[model samples]
Target: MENVKDLNHKPLSVKQYAIVSSLLFGLFFGAGNLIFPVHLGQLSGAHWVVAMLGFLCTAVALPLLSVLAISVTRSKGVYDIGRPLGPAFALGFMILIHATIGPLFGTPRTATVSFTVGVQPLLPKNAVHLGLLVFSGLFFLAAFLCSYKQSNIMTSIGKLLNPLFLVLLFATFLLGFLSPMGHAASQTVTSAYVNGSFFNGFLQGYNTMDALSGLAFGVTVVTAVNEMGKTNPISNSKVTAKAGVFAVGTIGLIYVGLVWLGATSLGKFNVSPDGGVAFNQIMNYYLGGVGHAFLATLLTLACITTAIGLVGAFAQDFHKHFPKVSYKVWLGLMCLASFLTANFGLDQIIAWSTPMLMFLYPFAMVLILLSVTSPLFHRDPVVYAWTVVCTAVPAFLEMISSFPPVVSQSGFGKAVTTFQSNYLPFASAGMDWVVPALVGAILGVTFHLVLKAKRNGAVESEKED
Candidate 1:
């Protein structure tokens, strides 16, 4: 097969750029994208605006910046972004990231969340389990089939599915807003959001984990731009940035709308355990019986498209890194694994995913931040190494603190949390690594400067002698 990257190229037209942006948006928006924002709104209640700002920072901003980082750095994936640290470190980071966003957590979540929000509400109470099992099996099977052939079906399905979803979604929004159950600003805030709604919302954004995906799947966007004829790295980077802006901006608006819908719906419903529930409540309230079928179809299609992308990325990457394994074998294994995990239900899946996201998001954030700013530091390994090491220490502790109550409340967990609260700045806001990362970066830069000075002095002495 000819390399698309090597083809003769020209700049993309405006309409072509829109399609690329839509493809990026479709890949990045799925599962947690649908569940997290509404849930934040439910908790934020009267403080939803403040909460939305924070959510936008991490969920929308970081992910888009991650894509930009990839473009500017001319890197393919997280593995390339993290290469400043070391080959061993970069490879490990890439593996962990892909695994989290692959069969281990993210892919399974696509099935579970869709089932929760769409199909579960329509099923008889006792049939929830069987329904999920059947739905997930078919879901993964379809995704696997699409991915196994290394086809562009994900993009094709997304081009069709996303527009339909948007139309139905906008209709729901119009109905919800025109006849809101209650005004959102006057709603009561949940205990968690009462004091630090923005901070809490920021933490809630961690659930989306799109930053990691942005880094992992960035090359896909880059490749899309390349195929559109912007083959030069600089031109491709500019085009990718433009597409990322449009896509991320659109996703951000949708998130704000979802949050607003959730905040307004509180007059008619109680706080739900997940956004899937809030989504169900709103859909049912607006469209009544028909909404169930519509939601199921939209969500299932949305989720399956997401599943196809996740599976394809994981299988293709693993095959590249370990070529002894065929892409088809990797695809099959990922499907089986995701199929099993998805049966755990959406709530359980989200609950467990929290710990891992807690751990990995900090790394992703630091990497993206550093990658974007690498020119200032000349891409020093010392900077990446120190910042990562310091960040990892607290991130690991935060992971423990975020575990489900049963484990997180244990003696060991308490000790870890206590250490974090007592010592780490911003621990309570769920960003315990911020101060340390800054300090680490400072130290790394200082050390690098000192070494440079010493080497210069040595050269001067040799010349004088």
Candidate 2:
């Protein structure tokens, strides 16, 4: 195989870049992306604009920044971002990221969410489980088949599914605006969203989990960029960055539209258990029974495309690390795992995954921050270690605090939670790690400068001698 570095002798044309950008957008914008923003809008009520800003910060901004960070680091995957920490840590972190975004949580979610929003409504209540089983079986099968051809993924998702997905989403948005449901609701804002709508929206955005997925997705984007002949690291990074901007812009517009639809539906529909339910209500209100059918088609295509992208990315990363396993085998295993997990249903899967997301997201954000700012700190390993360690401490506590009552109410857990609340700034807001991370970065840079100065002085003394 030609080396990725050697492949970048030529740059991609504007059209090629656009194709890659569209592909990235499709991969990242899945069921969760659609549901979360709408849910936020519904809950925020009169405070929807502030909430939207918050949602965009974490949902759109963080993920876009992650892609940019990946470009700047010239990373092939999440492993590269963690490599400075140590090989063991890098491998472990990559495994966690890929697994979480793969069959374990993300991939399965595509099936379950689609089933809940798309298929369940058409069936009798008693038959929902069996229906989910049957539906998910077909869903994963399609995803497996689509993911089988790894090389053609960009063309498949970018050229085929992306355009169709956009048209459907745009049509829905246009209809929503043309016939909004009694304007934004005058209902009381939910208590959680009342005082700190922005913070609440930010937290809600974490449920989409795109930032972590972006790390894994970065490899796929880079591969597509390489195939377009922009292989050199610098050129690859530039193209990836440009493509990321375009992709995020597309995603942001869709998110705003979805949120608007949700906000408008507040007066007409009751608050839903989740975004899928809320979206279903909105579609039905606008299009009636035909709307359900339309949403079903849209959800299935959206979910399957997302599943294919995630499964392919996971398999590719694992195959690279463990070449003997083979990409096809990895893909098969992932699809099978996702199939079984999807049977647990969307709510269960989400409940089980939320704590883990909380634990991992801050760490991922810190790593991206460090990677993007590494040049200022001379890319020192100490800086990476310190920043990550500081960030991890609060993140770990936050995760422990989020555990189910059986664990979180235990004495040790209570103590940790108490300490966090007492001393950590923004602990109540679920952003306790921010200050510590900044402090770690400052300390790391200072230490690096001191070490460098000492080494330079020693070299000068030796030359004089």
Best by TM-score: 2
lDDT tens digits by residue: candidate 1, 56-143: 9999999998998897787866788989988898889989998898877898999988888887767899999999999889889888
lDDT of each: 0.84, 0.87
Candidate closest to the true structure, highest lDDT: 2
- Model 2 stretches astray by more than 4 angstroms: 1-10, 185-187, 410-412
- Count clashes in each candidate, considering only residues at least 3 apart in sequence or on different chains: 0, 1
- Cα error, residue 341 of model 2, in Å, equals 1.0
lDDT for each residue of candidate 2 in 1-465, tens digit (9 for 90 to 100)? 234365546557788888988888878988999889989888988888889999998899999989988988888889999999999999999999988888778999999999899889999999998999999999888888888988778877988998898889889988987888857646557888888999988888898878998999988888887777777787888988998999998898888888777888888887788899999998888889998999998888788778888998998999999999999999999999999999998987898787788899998998988888888876799999888888888998988888777778999889989999999999988899899999988888888999999999999999999
TM-score of each: 0.94, 0.96
Q: How much is the lDDT of residue 419 in candidate 1?
A: 97
